[model samples]
Target chain A: MTDLYLQDWRAWTPHRETAGECRLDTREKPAGAAVPSMLRRRLNLLGRAVCDMLATLDSGADSIVLHASRHGDGERTLEMLYGLNDGEPLSPARFGLSVHNATVGVYSIASGNRRSQQAVAASGGEWAALMAEARGYLADGQPSVIIVFSDQPVPRRFAAYAPESSSAAVVLRLGRDPNPGARRLSETSVELELETATLQPLDIIDWLMDRRRVVACPLSRRSWQFPAVRP
Target chain B: MTTTALEHELKEMIIETLELEDVTPDDIDRDEPLFVEGLGLDSIDALELGLALQKRYGITLESEAESSRQHFANLKSLAALVESRRQK
Candidate 1:
């Protein structure tokens, strides 16, 4: 196991958007149109997000990357769905943006990234699932890098799934400094457990990534924060 | 499919993939160029269309092609390339 580390994290949102603005959006009211714009708001946001992340990570030219979002650009999908509901068929533009990889496409194009981006969605366990994937990359001997992203909830059509929580992004890295024992297929094994208390998977994710870590695991979540090394 | 049908399909795919915003299959001229003052595609469009073509058919575009400019000239040329490179 590589010594996993939280390299850093970055997030972006328009003044009108709320998938991520930190505590800027503290509304417990129902999520609705007033919520922040998630993906597809502005290409500038995509570039801004990626550029800021690169700086924060100190990522090299060849650093591998993975991004996770439960509803990748679902706000755009909701808009398209609403258009469809009005008996007005979706425009071709709407169709393109509706695809899950649209933002991924934008990121790749803007950054000129050569390595493939690991974009995955876990429906509910978005963060934990993505965290696991990031760890896999770390264990695989790649300079493990992961980016977790989520957007604000859509309109009332998705009311049950919403309290319009703000979106966030956290970037984790591993392998720069090797860990000892319980590291790999050799000597011993280490089990990495991430438990969250927030009702929303994203809420749990928010808890795990919060600077203060509102929730705590029995042992030291920070000590084990570094992955076991395979020395 | 006939050449015209292939061209139509290619146009649809372009409009769909590029998010051309206000374009339709009918809006595109069958023989119009797709790049450089035609459909006006840039590098990103090339990447997306290339991927879509590979999945739809089995012809993977050479990422480092020297003359992709001429290859993506327009819908007609793209249709021809797709037909000629159609997987056996």
Candidate 2:
């Protein structure tokens, strides 16, 4: 298992507390100062969500960025495809940001971060893969790594095939070398036994913020144990 | 449609199609450029606005690539282009 410090973290979701229908809103809401207006205007919902959390974490300029998303920019991808089907010329900005790592690129531009960045996605084992990637960065002697996991629900046409999905982002600033041998248990030591593979990153953020040392999330089979916090 | 009314409609279309929030048609200046300097739009907005205008005004810019750039210079130019084409 990877041993790393959860130095800081932040999470955001577009859903407002409401009794109305559950759906994705594509508006580019103001996230933070990390993204300037010129760049912010170009970001789609997923990019804005990712940047919102990243800004909150104050991610290091040198920290490696690992953006793991099961469905990266799903809505934009669908729009591009539909535009193609109708023989319409796609917007250059949409085409530019539709790539998997586009959000990470935007983050780099916003924060002036030139460190190594990687995009990871898997039908299963996404979190596990993210952990492995962070471990690799630490082993390479990097000071820290930022892992931003974001996802948006698949479009309605593909909703039938996908599990329940929503738009959310989680940014974690992790480090292995914590202040010259601090003996605190690493956050990586936490074990989450999840029943379903569909573990939303927001659940992990909630668990980290709560006072509880262990959590069996209500709507999920994910049971997490945080031995790092034990006195 | 009058130029003033068409300009208002263009502003609304720009805001809606661009997904711009906290902005209204009254906020847009008829003489201000829509790209880069005035409205701060980029090439992507130009493409989106072109599509919207084509659909709404039932006009085509197929034969006028160079003039299309001129038409998109500002709200007045865009309205003039739309009005000129709508009368045809």
Candidate 3:
């Protein structure tokens, strides 16, 4: 188990449009001004949330990207399916962007960051998987890794089983060096415990944003503790 | 619709269907390429445009792969395809 420092992070979600259903106190939609219109037009709600978080995070080409999503843009998949079922030609863009890693691909091209990218789809242990992946990058002696986790509620058809959440995105820049540059926000040490999982990364983001230290979140069958962040 | 009107409608359809908020019909060159270099559209856009054209014109694009590819080559080609099919 390695102690990872949380150099920087950002979270985003829709506020007004989803106020009735999604209770998360999220900010307004992301403008994604940096992204060209060509690619931005293709982004759905999930992709928009990710782009919003990325726009706020000061990431560079050197940073490794790790994207985690419980259910990636499920709504888009449903739309494509409906179109196909109706014997209508599916939009190639919609079909292409429905995949798990479509957001990652768009980010790479839009941000011009050719660094290695990883996409993780976890049914329950997503946070654990993301942390583990970041640890591997740190062990490789990389300076920093950008981990983005996002999820959106599935269509009404799957809502019974999945009970989708409002669209959300959390971006974390993990680094080995505790003393990050001027962009340094806070430092967190992650330790995976052997207990059953309970809390999630989104909960951790809220806690961290609220400046709450000493958080104990679960990872898979184990629990991890994030001690108070240091300057 | 006349050629100019058809071009205008096509542009509107492309923008609305593809969700290209920043682009207007006037911005499109009549004979400019639709995918990649000119409009920077990809295969996905092609599929979407094809579907949109089919629905708007009340016609089915021929399944001839190579000919269909040519019809989608640019706004001019797409316009021609729409015009011919609508007239037929």
Candidate 4:
């Protein structure tokens, strides 16, 4: 079991209620003004959402960033695949941005953040893996870790493979000490029953907003539990 | 040198292919450098532009060739290259 404190969090989605400082506006794409136009132009919906959340999170410079996604920029990959099948060369920009770590790499470059950045992808328990990675960073004596989880609907061709396909990003700052307004996040191993994989970001947002208690994220055979936020 | 119709077309192609939302064909100076200076495009943009040129006009560039650099130097040079070597 791993115990960590959530220093702060911000989440974004196409459909969500405005919660405190975090506003949900689905009318327009996130400007991501922190990122220069050159790099911003390359961000897709998921990347923009992640950047948007990061902009408001105000993560410290020393904090490590971990980006977790179930299907990272699958649409870009699909486009490149189509071009290759048609005997046409892929767009170099699209080809470069198709990797799972591309968005976080762009974020790191845009923010001028030289801290360690990592990307992870798992079939069902990506959120747990992300938190575990953050825990590992904390164990390594890092003061804080920024975890960004972003996922979007896969291309239509691969939609059937994903149980839950939605666009959302959640950014959480984790630390060893519980600061003011911080929530306690506890990870415990539990027997996992057969359950459809839920969109972890939305679940996290719901938990942060006090709409839900205890985020039970099931990976393969084990589940990570986050106990209810203490008052 | 005057901006020819081909140069204008190439500018449009650059703006569209690069997704330069703030840039228009008229915003591109015919003689301005396209890399690291005038238009502020980088190596990735150059590669994307190369692929766009290949797809639209069936043009290709040899890797690391001094002549290729000259052809991609500016809008006028790119239009001239297309005029001479376009397969489609």
Winning candidate number (lDDT):
4
lDDT of 2 by residue, A22-115 (tens): 2222234645556877677767766777776676565456677898888788888898999899998677677878889998898888888887
Better of 2 and 4 by DockQ: 4
In candidate 3, position B33 carries an lDDT of: 87
The DockQ of each candidate is 0.04, 0.33, 0.73, 0.81
Off by over 4 Å in 2: A1-3, A13-33, A41-46, A59-62, A79-83, A86-93, A179-198, A210-231, B58-66, B86-88
Q: What's the CA RMSD of model 3 in angstroms?
A: 5.0
* Residue range A1-231, candidate 3, lDDT tens digits: 455677777666652233342323265656766578898888875676676566556455556789988778788888889888998777777788888999988888888888889888877567768877988988888777888878766688889976436566778788877754323233244565645343344555555555454444344443344543444
Q: What is the C-alpha lDDT profile of model 2 across B1-88, one tens digit per residue?
A: 6778878888888988886765778878888888888878877677777777777777777635889889998899998888888633
Q: Decide which is better by TM-score, 1 or 2.
A: 2
Off by over 4 Å in 3: A14-26, A55-58, A180-201, A211-219, A229-231, B58-70
Q: TM-score (chain A) of candidate 3?
A: 0.79
List TM-scores for all candidates, in order.
0.51, 0.75, 0.81, 0.92
lDDT by residue (tens digit), candidate 1, A1-231? 444555444444332334454522233321222112222233323333544454445345356666666666666778878877987544444466557565555555444567767777664455555555766776877765645454555556786764455444444444444344212211122333644332233443444444333332212232123223433
**Interface RMSD, candidates in the order listed:** 9.1, 2.4, 1.8, 0.8
Sort every candidate by DockQ, greatest first: 4, 3, 2, 1
Residue lDDT tens for model 1, B49-73: 7767876777777778865666787
- In CAPRI terms, where does candidate 2 land? acceptable
Docking class of 3: medium
Model 2, residue B60: C-alpha shift (Å): 4.1
lDDT of 3 at A8: 72
Ranking of predictions according to TM-score: 4, 3, 2, 1
Cα error, candidate 3, residue B38 (Å): 3.6
Q: Candidate 1, clashing residue pairs? A: A1-A183, A4-A227, A17-A36, A17-A37, A18-A36, A19-A152, A19-A166, A19-A167, A20-A167, A179-A229
